[model samples]
Target: MPAADAGGTPDPLRRLTLADLRRRTSMKWRTYEPDVLPLWVAEMDVPLAEPVAEALTEAVRLGDTGYPAGTVYADALRDFARHRWDWDFPASRTALVPDVMLGIVEVLKLVTGPGDAVVVNCPVYPPFYQFVRHLGRRVIEAPLDAAGRLDPAALESAFARATEGGRRAAYLLCSPHNPTGTVHTEDELADVAARAAARGVRVVADEIHAPLVLPGARHVPYLTVPGSETGFALLSASKAWNLAGLKAALAVAGSAAARELAAMPEEVGHGPSHLGVIAHTAALRHATGWLDSLLAGLDRNRRLLGELLTRLLPGVRHRPGEGTFLAWLDCRALGLGDDPAAAFLDRGRVALNSGLPFGTGGAGHVRLNLATSPEILQEAVRRMASAVPDTGRRTREDP
Candidate 1:
């Protein structure tokens, strides 16, 4: 359980239980069998922020749910970015979409044509490959460095290949990268922007996890870089505030990219939920306190998970990355084969995301969600340790 603050208030995030969480009907809870603990999705187990809940409640009371209108969401994001990230996002250059992935796809369509190459840093977010390919575009790989950080040399190589044959291409960048939780430093992002500019490759950054950056790290919005004036970024309060089910996101265009962004069809804006815009706007505009508390809880959970893994699953190499609630675990040393998530799911009934789908560098890994209560996190590690086969090394007390 989370300790009480100075005011004696219990942390809401730490108060959840497996029994309570299982009652929800989200995919994270419903996809697995009755006894399985599902921790594969990006959903958090925390309750809604007070302001967001109130906003949605008011909307429901007034029956204000209709087509999204006005610039409230964009205005809120502008204020949030200026205050939180020191980025002066122009609300005039923003557009709404259903979610980050869909927004990225629409942006890709605006910037690149069919059969154009799209570069991604591998062991990356799986959907980057899926959505790009789904648009009839070719996917190009730029695998991360061994330490899970972006590799400029690899990216340069990928950009070179992506722009061959005089074909236009785009780089699908994952800011505060998923699965690995690696937050790209400002210097790294600047380098990416510079290289992409030189190679005539447009950069599309997915910054959904921007506001959830843990302590001791900073999130550098890619569009803020000097050479990124033409790049586009996909952002959403959904990820930071756990409003994924609500479905609203913004596609922000850099100063020079406004023309291309304006080219996005108006029909794309129709996909966003009006209530989602309301909830997300309220979150960005008035819920920083709630976001701060959530970040603190996530920071604690990340550190706690590290300690737990050391004790219960020593061979499962892990280092809590800078941001997000996801932890990438190298399970090769556990002798669990290439897809370690499969072994854990079959033996321990703990459903984790398999690494194979992340492509390259992902063969011997599993992505663990660290957004649950401390007790559930502990139990998950214990179950994972117990699931290892007899052929693998075990603790002294193992029967």
Candidate 2:
């Protein structure tokens, strides 16, 4: 059970039981056999936020399912930014897209061309590599610094090489980044904008996890940084609210980039589902209280995972991230060789995301989801510790 919050209420992650989760048909639960505990994937185990569920129910009752229209989604997001991050943009600066990754593809098209270079910080989200290659664009690697923060030197080198022949290049930045969950700070983002501007590299930021930032973190929207006026940002409530099944996102342009967003083809705006728009907007505007509860829950889980690792696994190194429900564990010390998740699945009956797919610096690491019940997380760590060969646990106590 989750410890009660300051107000004596249990957070969302503990609301569901193992049997309750197995009944669902989502990929997270369905991917593994019933005996295998799933700590991979970004999906949360919590139920829908009340406001979002109410909004969807009301829409269904009124038979409001149809094509997406108007700027309600954008309007809701703008309100959220104003209150949460002290940032603001006019309705004229936003457009609807199918989702964050697809929105990134469209933005990349607006700024780059076929065979051009797209730079990404390595050990990043796997889709960044896959999608860039699928679009006929080359991916240039700029690995993060040792502490998992964006490395300015690496970015400079990558930018220099990407535009070697004066060919157009784009940087696909993940803000409040996935997998590692490193929230880029204002100064870091400012440096990126300046560097990209100096090197003639256009920037497209994916801020899907902005709303998922936990306590002690302030997620700076890339477009809000100085010199970022020409860059673009793509955001959605899908990640923070666990509404991935709904397909809708908003693309926001800085003051100097509005014209580029405006020039997007008319057909490009037809992909968002109306129901998705309603749910996303509802989540942004009305479910903020629920969001607060979720953040509290996820923060607790993050620390809990670290505690379990120290006590049972010992060899694993986990630095609890400042945001999101993902914790990146370095299992190199355990001698798991490149892909420890494979061993965990085969020997421990636990499913975790292999880190190899995240590019450089990913080997010997695994990304674990912290958005589940505390009891389940405890069990998963015990199983993972048992997968290690012949080493006495470095610690012997359970909180």
Candidate 3:
């Protein structure tokens, strides 16, 4: 077991230093040069939770590398949801999928069709645009409010535009939103459900980040809201438990959407890795303590980032996210043009995610992963601060 922080929670982020993290071969680390401090991707620096690791190890030891069986994964999620957020849904209403994004694609197929408009809150997960367009569906943007909250008017406008010509449309919602980390409040979600219902638009919420909701915020399951019984949700332990590489997720159907979910090809359940299912089940069933510790470390790192930017890189603006270990940065003030991440990587040798890919309102912004050690976070900020041009100013006056 690891030592606990002042909050009496194990600081998972503290367990890995830059040196230790460098050994990682994941996209988060390997995408950049070894000398660069990579903080662009969602992969966390912490080791796997003991329970999850033990489960996978046991599975392999017994040569249980076969297809998944039973509703154990969904049952575990149900227990976690009920305990954590007071939410519940019968296991029969869920379907196993390869992963969240693929699951989203599958669900979208059931709700919308080719040439149909699929609405998304802009500056969202880029994959939303990619997958939707690839499926031959149109991507309609409904930009978020200035503070990164969902905008009712924007949604209404998009919904109206989408349902034009009596076409079926779907709204792909990112609850506990990525990059911004805005956890949708219950009232906000209720409004979304009502508005989406009234507009005849199906809601497909991606709540993969639900379990990672930080302090002072709560995650409202979109399906739990009134008027949302016809919607669908994609949930997974991938983001919360660092199991993205394992690849397994659940597709949940709202009460009225259950039949539509069942219409999904039975073969879809065969896509997820059997081991991935086991790992996710173990995480939800027995890794709550580890998740809590990770939340503590993330909370601390978010605060630390705000302070670092204030002192070291004043030109950059960041609002600490309400959930998840990601931070959206407004680097527009830095005069680095639209893609400040490029500048940071080239000059500072710190690779942060470019804002260009995140869609409207994303330019001049960057998405940073905060799930690393305090030392790496501090070093990354220092490198970013050094990357800014001085404009021929004297000591302490430069960026």
Candidate 4:
């Protein structure tokens, strides 16, 4: 007997197996083998892009698995940056850091200090809050407005309050926002930049998921906005190509102010992995079509899951996801006790991110990553609908 071969389809969204459709997703971190499905973690089950794998294999075959040094590595990264995002990222300003978290820490070191206040949007990536606290800075939650998108006025208010309190220094921005999946508009980014600049706050934009943006949504590079040069851009190939293990990310600084943020002592002395260099270049050149196919697959899964939730369990409110693969589910109407994460895990046998960690407003919600196959989503939804209490439900309009 032999294992069946799934088509070497570069697209991860379309591949689903009968087993996948039957299993529950797991969100537990302690145990890798969850009895239920495992969708809680951000990692995807897809194999690496063929080109990325080939590049790594070729690098290993040549036995060049040492620390990166010299101009060739920088040139490869520069070329990829120019081609992929259409931005003129100067290779000179780019530093090959080991990972994005390190980049964030370094930026925090430079732009802020103990007793300083760091502004971040609510329901953001958890690390944004952690990074600020780890650096001994106070966190000011400038939560997104009612639309689940950045509200410029709220940001201005937060900035003013921080200034009045004399704790302002840095702001961390997630472009294609996490948890909520709202892609910020150009005007929104500009307003944030203008406000931050006025209050002498430097912005660090984490764009790790920029490459994974869905169709019909434009990704505006933070530096592209006027006065954006006052901010630093943090990006990585980890999320898009699933190369996180290779551990190479870039910190791109446009203006002198931003460059100063990147040149902190804590940021220095880190080395880049040779494999990350090779894979990133291969992905930029050969994986464009693959990325497009994957995005389409993600979009389909998102819609399918939304539709299923609507029909089977009407109270679960979900919008058509705009950017990232994450689906923000409003499970307030289910009324299955207070903790939705625990309820879904225990009763539904589906492990999902608890919405409370995202912020107070995220309470009674759950964040589901739709990056997996359609079959998996179907089963996950099935478990959820089964576990949810039978409260008389209403459609989206009833809310």
lDDT of 2 at 294: 86
RMSD of each: 2.3, 2.4, 2.2, 3.9
Off by over 4 Å in 3: 1-9, 391-399
Local distance difference test, each candidate:
0.90, 0.91, 0.91, 0.74
lDDT of 1 at 5: 41
Tens digits of lDDT, candidate 1, 1-399: 475444444555787777889899999999989899888999999888889999999999999989999789999998999998999877789998899999999999988999999999999889998999999999999999988899999999999999999899999999999989999998999999999999999999999999979999999989888899999999999988889999899999999999889889999999999999999999999888777877777888899998988777877778788998899999887889999999999999899999999999899899999888888888898889889865454543555
lDDT by residue for model 4 (111-146), tens? 777888878899787877776788788888888887
In model 4, the runs with Cα more than 4 Å from the true position are 1-10, 16-32, 71-84, 165-168, 258-262, 266-271, 392-399
Q: Write the per-residue lDDT of candidate 3 for residues 1-399, one digit (tens) a residue.
A: 555755676788877767777777889878877898899888888989999999999999999999998999999999999999899999999999999999999999998889999999989999999999999999999999998999999999999999999999999999989879999999999999998988899999999999999889999899888899999999999988899899899999999999999999999999999999999999999989899889988898899998898878777767889998899999887878999999999999999999999999999999999988888899999999888876411233454
Clashes by residue pair, model 2: none
The candidate 4 region of ten consecutive residues with least summed lDDT is 1-10
Give the TM-scores of the predictions, in the order they appear.
0.96, 0.97, 0.97, 0.89
Error of 1 at 237 (Å): 0.7
Query: Which candidate would rank higher by TM-score, 1 or 4?
Result: 1
lDDT of 3: 0.91
Query: Could you tell me the lDDT of residue 17 within candidate 2?
Result: 90
Residues 1-399 of candidate 2 have per-residue lDDT tens digits of 565567655677878899998998999989989999999998999888888999999999999998999999999999999999999999899989999999999999999999999999989999999999999999999999989999999999999999998999999999988788899999999999999999999999999999999899899999999999989999999988999998999999999999999998877789988989999999999988778888888888888888888778887877779988899989887878999999999999999999999999999999998899989999999999888885535432322
